[model samples]
Target: MAKWGEGDPRWIVEERADATNVNNWHWTERDATNWSSEKLKELLMGLWVEGEEGKCEITEVSKVE
Candidate 1:
């Protein structure tokens, strides 16, 4: 949901991390350069979707992350 891929949507869903903590991740191009395609994409997804307040949080808890 972070809308990782730049040009299009891939429907690749992933888990969500702690909303208030970006402690371990280094969300930058350098860090992503070494990642596998899937891994890099996941990171990208993590970038924008992590903070969405209502879009993903409802009725049931998000199973992501």
Candidate 2:
């Protein structure tokens, strides 16, 4: 099983989660400018379960341009 840092854009399907330093994410890739942060924020914020409120962490994201 391999582990990825917070700077990583993807995670492997490992049996366990590994910890890594991400103080500097300069190695991280950038998405296209066509993507709208506001729209994405709105969509992610809509993950509420209504009657059953909960929070989720975004482990993955992508952009098409």
Candidate 3:
């Protein structure tokens, strides 16, 4: 499985005019300001757990653009 926050390798930071490959799709990280609380919770749960006592806690969320 891919690591969280590292993003997908198929994602590009810039757009290509002659882009014709599915592996070269432009994907940028947009601001999460408009995300709902439920949406955030779902994402947090997707995190990898190490042990039985592993717990995920989200204390703060920052605005990204």
Candidate 4:
């Protein structure tokens, strides 16, 4: 662990008027729900499976939530 007032330089965030995450020490969140849903629907919509007896196909993706 780093001592008080003597933290590693790479882990320090520079002082600025806007306290942005320059060093990226703080966690950030991004909303990719819609994008992930759409990507899943696209990838799963036309998937198909075949067996010795029968075959199956995914014609539509109704919901991906």
Estimate the TM-score of every prediction.
0.19, 0.21, 0.21, 0.58
Local distance difference test, candidate 3: 0.59
Q: Write the per-residue lDDT of candidate 4 for residues 1-65, one digit (tens) a residue.
A: 76677888786455678877654568676899999999998898879999998989999888877
Clashing pairs in 4: none
CA error at residue 6 for candidate 2, angstroms: 56
The per-candidate count of clashes, in order, stands at 5, 0, 0, 0
lDDT string for model 3 (21-42, tens) is 5553546556666576557766
Instruction: Give the 10-residue window scoring lowest on summed lDDT in candidate 4.
Output: 20-29
List ranges where model 2 is wrong by over 4 Å. 1-35, 48-65
Error of 4 at 24 (Å): 4.1
The 10-residue segment with the lowest total lDDT in model 1: 56-65
Residue 24 in model 2: lDDT = 35
Which is the leading candidate under TM-score? Answer: 4
Q: Write out the backbone clash pairs for model 3.
A: none
* Model 3, TM vs. native: 0.21
RMSD (Cα, Å) for all candidates, in order, is 21.9, 15.9, 14.6, 6.5
Q: Could you tell me how far off, in angstroms, the CA of residue 28 lies in candidate 4 after the best superposition?
A: 3.5
